[model samples]
Target chain A: MAEPTPSLAPARPPTGPRVWNNPRARAIIYQVLVLGGVIGAAAYLIDNTLTNLAERSIRSGFSFIWHEAGFAISEALIDYQPNHSYVRAFIAGLLNTLKVGLLGIVLVTILGIIIGIARLSTNWLVARLASVYVETFRNVPLLLQLYLWYSLLTEMLPGGRDALSLFTAFYLNKSGLMYPVPVYDGIHPFMIVAFLIGCVGAYAWGRYATRRHEATGVPTPRFWPSVGFVLGLPLVVWLIGGAPTAIDVPQMERFRFVGGWHVSIEFIALLLGLVVYTGAFVAETVRAGILSVSRGQTEAALSLGLRRGLVLRLVLLPQALRVIMPPLTSQYLNLMKNSSLAVAIGYPDLVAVANTTLNQTGQAIEAIAVIMAVYLTISLAISGFMNWYNKRVALVER
Target chain B: MINLAERRAASGPVIQMAGVNKWYGEFHVLKNINLEVRSGERVVVCGPSGSGKSTMIRCINRLEEHQKGRIVVDGIELIADLKQIDAVRREIGMVFQHFNLFPHMTVLENLTLAPMWVRNTPRKEAEDAAMAYLERVKIPEQAHKFPGQLSGGQQQRVAIARSLCMKPKIMLFDEPTSALDPEMIKEVLDVMIELAQGGMTMICVTHEMGFARTVADSMVFMDGGEIVEKAPPTEFFKNPKSERTKLFLSQILH
Candidate 1:
């Protein structure tokens, strides 16, 4: 060891010789430099893009979105004239996307949960069938599946006079699936009010039944009463108010059927493809989540004398959902993003309509930005909702 | 119902197993095991690993199906009948090795679950019973806490309290103290000993010979899917009848 320094001199601080040499200071400096580099790179790209747009004499902004879009969408949920603004077309397209995405989420979750449980069934045939379904749908590319469904609906189904008619109100043909629309004359609002009241009454009834069940051992059946609440009240009110609702059956008049609600083949193809494809991955996620809980949980619950159904409802599902929710949120987000593939099947989703706007207006950057912004908003919304749900079901692992 | 109550109150054996055999696929896990546990008797079963000690007790609650056996609990015979299985399970409470408390529920909720759902006890009544049991197990302060928040010993005690809330006639403990830390084992064993002193019929599968000696009315030594020797704890420890029991006792005690 070196000789000790003179005691009179100021004692050297324990840390380091300089601020630059200090670990905490160095870490801050390194992060600042990385942040600067990232900002500089982003600034450069933005500048380059601006300069290129100027050189090409292309106006880049959302101003042109208000211009008229002359192109017509084959299928629209809202009324759209060809003379309507591109903004209107974009709104319709966005609604289409939301419609399909929401429906797909619901259908896929049901299908996935059913298949997931069936795969774990003791019945060999049911398990095998679910396995076969999962393998078949998951292995095929979604785009290819969409194409196949599109062709099948367009080509396989007979056209015109040979249209397959279900009862007198529904028709299936090359055009699309058509179903009867109820045309309400007067007193529609009263019927709607009655329906709403029935729903609230039914909810109160359920709460009362649950309370009664807890107080006594007698369980009140909820299904038939719920059905009556939904359908019976509305029907009763309609009859009392001079039943003004009439079914508008579609009439086959030569080329196409008239006066009915129609779902286009493109919409059908996109929906089927998205739901069936995403459902397989969801099924696997569900299975893994349920399996992650140890078998002892069920044994303990059953041994405590709970019924089989009660054991599953109280013990298995709560634990399983804790493991299921986080990954299930990601699967939902993926499904929403995958809906951008609608362009391949001629479905007028946001991307498809935005592409048309870009081609017509020559405002490529703005169009692309709009599409990105909408997708980002939708993704954030879905994740936000799911995060709340996940927190509610999360284990209290204090 | 009157006859059934009369039979149950006659003070015969609460649990009986005769010529019980079980197999997992092709491997025989339990072989021709015969055992009996009377009312309010504490039977401690000790065995080496894979000796079918847990399996034999599990058969009493029908957690594991015995392929060939005449197992009966509380005057009702165990069979493939779902109704009878549920009835027997309702009367017999079990505690697992890992303290398999429902992690999602609070300690009080876990205790009240079976009482409310199975026994149809009202909420206030179930909660009252649960709090009483929690006090008995000496963890009433942690009644609202989740299982994960408690130590291993505390969770095991909560599990025992949960079982007692059901008012079970017979309790089966499958290695209750096996999963606890060394210091924590004493607390759990203390609770179990208190439970024993209160005249609750209990069949415990464990290696805690000291505990067995303290509370067990009879000690059973099992080896390789069969009971080798069984006697009062003092006699069993002093003079084990079988060579395997002697070897096991030497290895464990030394």
Candidate 2:
């Protein structure tokens, strides 16, 4: 038999019409036209707005950001006075927003996972309760829930003078929650350092235990020992420092409580509303993610003599996480944005502070732009992190 | 290898099921199944679809609960006790039609997971055992690859190796080759033949009559959730006494 020669010659390109009539050329032209239209529209809007501002004799610039903000904020994490600049007010509002957002994300995740697992519980009552929670919270609007919480906190609680007391150290009233705080002492910083060291020690111990278990067949006790290292070390340090027993507890004064740390009812209401509402959606996401894993995976693991808990931790969760991450990221972003509704309840989040600044300075455009930029940055950061995590958990396949 | 007859005589029945009955909701799936499988014995269960063959073996490991019956595996009674179920499961390995290999893990990891976690074997020991099994199955080079990266035949062989890593006394196969292509079926059957020749007690539910003839010491024909006939493969093939058995054999064989 004769060997067939391989064809190595390159095929000739299609001899078609001129560049103007070519398909690729038309595609490029169409894309350029669309791009130009979008840019032209944006430039027109900006020019029109600037011309209108000048004609109305309205000063439009970001210089107003440095001017004095002669307004009282309801709450502030950092020091802020009416004499402070608008920049300081904006920072306070941003901090408030971040405080609620970060805490809400953590609490909602924990609650969502618990409720999600509970929804699948064989016990009828627990499953029913979880479903009810998801349905009720997710069905109602978030703003309404915030309003309801705010009203309940402000109207139902007793007056500051007759605040409800818990163990004579914490006070709850319409004014806010007042809790005891430790008095500053030189030993306190040392105690914190000791606590940090204990944390590092616990982490190192956990790693070592895992390595030892893998190297040797014998397993070591991990949970309790790590706990002892973290908490026991702090306790030892406290004892060694002759633990200062001086704590400033709240006391009823002429009008309100004095001393101790105070938490505003607005902040509490905002956090409660955000967490409860977002937690319901997160629960559904969790349930769906878990259900996405096939029953065969569970049966295979069980057949291998692994316990149900081990099957869930090792096999089910790793697969379920891939399905859960994308939706969970959007849920987090939604929670952050929905936090803007805090303005309705007077929590003074970014939107609320920006609203005040715009009303005072007549720089609605700049204020709104700043608000948009901040939200855009937060949303992108969250999505970027979730994407990275999703990739890590994704399955490898041909 | 030890003589099969001597090995069988040395040990009593490893799996015993008497008056086993099961139901799925309102439907009766298995009704009064009574069987005994001695050590080093290979029982091939062949039947029409929905004949309760899969359900019967699933009951041996307590994967499917029997509503009313006594199933004692290795002297451990199958009951609501979790410890007992886990104990019996450790001695029994099961392979499914879909291969059910954990896609998230490599072939080596899948084989090593149960031994390292349940048996508390060290990582090095588990990997060594896994590599040996992979070599026995003739796919040692694919150890680091994921299950999804392998062919159907290779995946099935890996699944078999995974079961063997646990060093179980008995292995259950439910349609192990039914899901594979015609070309891939022989590779899986060859592995099973090798395993059978090694004196492993196996209960395989399959439609591959040639494999049954080659390896199965006993043949069981089930119809309508009951074993219609049980006999030696030579006797069962040459002269099926029951009408249902004759009909099933003719349908499958021709």
Model 2 global lDDT (CA atoms, 0 to 1): 0.92
* lDDT, candidate 1, A89-173, per-residue tens: 9999999999899999999899989999889889999999999999999999988998999898889998876889889788888
How far does residue B174 in candidate 2 sit from its true spot (Å)? Answer: 1.1
Candidate 1 docking band: medium
How high is the lDDT of residue A314 in model 1?
86
| Model 2 Cα shift for residue A15 (angstroms) | 12
Please give, for residues B192-252, the per-residue lDDT of candidate 2 as tens digits.
9999999899999999999999999999989888888889999999999999998998998
lDDT of residue B202 for candidate 1: 93
Cα lDDT of model 2 by residue, A5-34, tens digit? 998889779786688788899999999999
- Give, for candidate 1 chain A, the lowest lDDT window spanning 10 residues: A213-222
The best candidate in terms of DockQ? 2
**Reference-based lDDT, residue B33, model 1:** 89
